[model samples]
Target: MKIHVWNAFASNNSGSYTIVGRFPSEELAAQVAAELSEVLAAHEQWFRSPTAPRSGEGSRRETPSPLRAFAQVHSLTQGESDWADQGELRAWSTGHQVFLHDPCTLSLPDSYEEFLRVRGGKVETRIRHAHADIVSLFELRGTLPKKTKAETVRALVEELHADDGPLVTLAPFNLQPAWREGSKPGEPVLTVGAVFHDRDLATGFTAVEGLARRHGLDVTVRVSEEQDSRDSLAWLRPSHPPLKRKMFDVWLLEAGYSPKEVARRLGELRHGRYVDVPGLLKALPDTVLKRLTLSRAEQAVRFLREGGANAELRPAE
Candidate 1:
């Protein structure tokens, strides 16, 4: 029997810590377990509280809480040892080793095998050892929405099968939804790891923008200097003032600025108290001009005509 023992330290916030090692025989496995128990006991003693404060009144205090160390033992058998007394235990242990070491080994139990196949070769094996702290070991970094406990478990399985490395022990952390209004108690929170590609990041940004829009939040894409200059010149002309005002209103709405702020800024610009021509241009898309609020339709047309003329004036030279 090739037995393995893992000691996992788990915390409420930091997730889990794991110590894994292999043993050649049942006797070795027993020895390893005893060693592990001693290590944990010694660790506990190191964490024990002292009789008195070692430092001054302003000094930080270190105290031992519910945090403790625990260990798990797993055995791998080739022949008669495989015929275990308990079916689930036998199946879980066997599947765990095979899943960890051999990517090609695929004679898992029907239900779990089917689950893995459906998940596109992503499978995680979690052995419920005599100790409950060691939740599971993962070999992959899986991607899944942290919306439900079931989804989280599914993600763990996928990560274990997909990643190629030493097993990573995982226990639930502060998993909760980003938004909580519609979320139920004990509902898992969803967080996506950063996407590396620019295109993927842009797509994610767009999706988040849409969600914000749905929730009555303003979303804006900042304009470049050239665009700002061009937009401003267009707004200053007397042609499509209404359209320009409407566009400014939209810009302000997207920029997450309140109408009052827009009005105040425009007031400053008009009185020559602020050199905010570029800002004014940017604001035109979402703000209505104070003097010409009623004539927005006419103002917008004039702005469009002026913008067209400005576009033509820029020479190829």
Candidate 2:
């Protein structure tokens, strides 16, 4: 059995639902689902910002959270897991905007295809044009006051609006297609959300707080330094065309990452990807270690340990 995190989006009296995550166990699925729930609850009003003032609706009362999106845990038997087998693996390379799928019930009419080919590996959709389907995203990490949340987001949107839309950060989970190509395009992708982009924008969105002077909305935007690995490893399987260090630009090499070594070691992993030191550091525990023995294979680990000399080390699992 597999557990799935089902997400639904609603606006203008219509909405759609799809699976965002599929986990082998209920624990992880529940965790992800709960996180998404809290995120949407904290930030939903941001998506529900009025395009124009509404007339005669009595007094505006705060609606329950998730006015535009909702998420919950879903159970599936083995037979229902067949959708995972239909798609081909695609390597996620940087330098292009990849649109996985827009599950937003309020998005503009889509301008991209909605299918995956077995050999062609068009399983993932990425576009090159800047204005085609690009959007800025700012994932909110904390809660906000319900009374002022809508106004807070309105100010944010107004601040971010240059031509397209404001940079919005919703839940971190990726919504999987309700059904791929050959099947009809799901209603979820029909309309554009106030702001929705399946992937992170090439640029960052950290300057939101300074835009407005008054509202104390607690929003934290986390922009991953390693977008290449973040995008490629977001899904649950191996990539078809393996990612290599050479595929990355010179900036990474100039930043002290060993390109030749990255190229060599990427091929060695099961997924042909590398999770850098900073990523590993974030996942490590805060407990400090006295003296730990290391193996030759852990030479890199030894090198890192030598730097802090007082750094913590979680025991290897």
TM-score of model 2 relative to the true fold? 0.17
- Model 2 gets an lDDT of 0.27
lDDT of 2 by residue, 67-167 (tens): 22221112112221111211211112111112122223322212112211211223232332122222222323224455755454544444443222222
How do the residues 1-317 of candidate 1 rate in per-residue lDDT, one tens digit apiece?
99999999974332111122233333443343444345434534444446423333444335321112121121112221111111111111111121211111113223323322332332333321111122121111223344553444333323321212011111111110011111344322222221111112223333433333332333222111122212222322332111211111111233123434434443332322233545644654433322222233244334433333111111111
- Scored by lDDT, model 1 comes in at 0.26
| RMSD to the hidden true structure, all candidates | 25.2, 22.6
- Pairs that clash in candidate 2: 106-192, 106-193, 107-191, 107-192, 107-193, 108-191, 108-192, 138-168, 138-169, 139-169
Task: Name the lDDT value of residue 86 in candidate 2.
Answer: 15
Q: lDDT of all predictions, in order shown?
A: 0.26, 0.27
Q: Where in model 2 is the C-alpha error above 4 Å?
A: 1-137, 141-144, 162-206, 212-214, 224-317
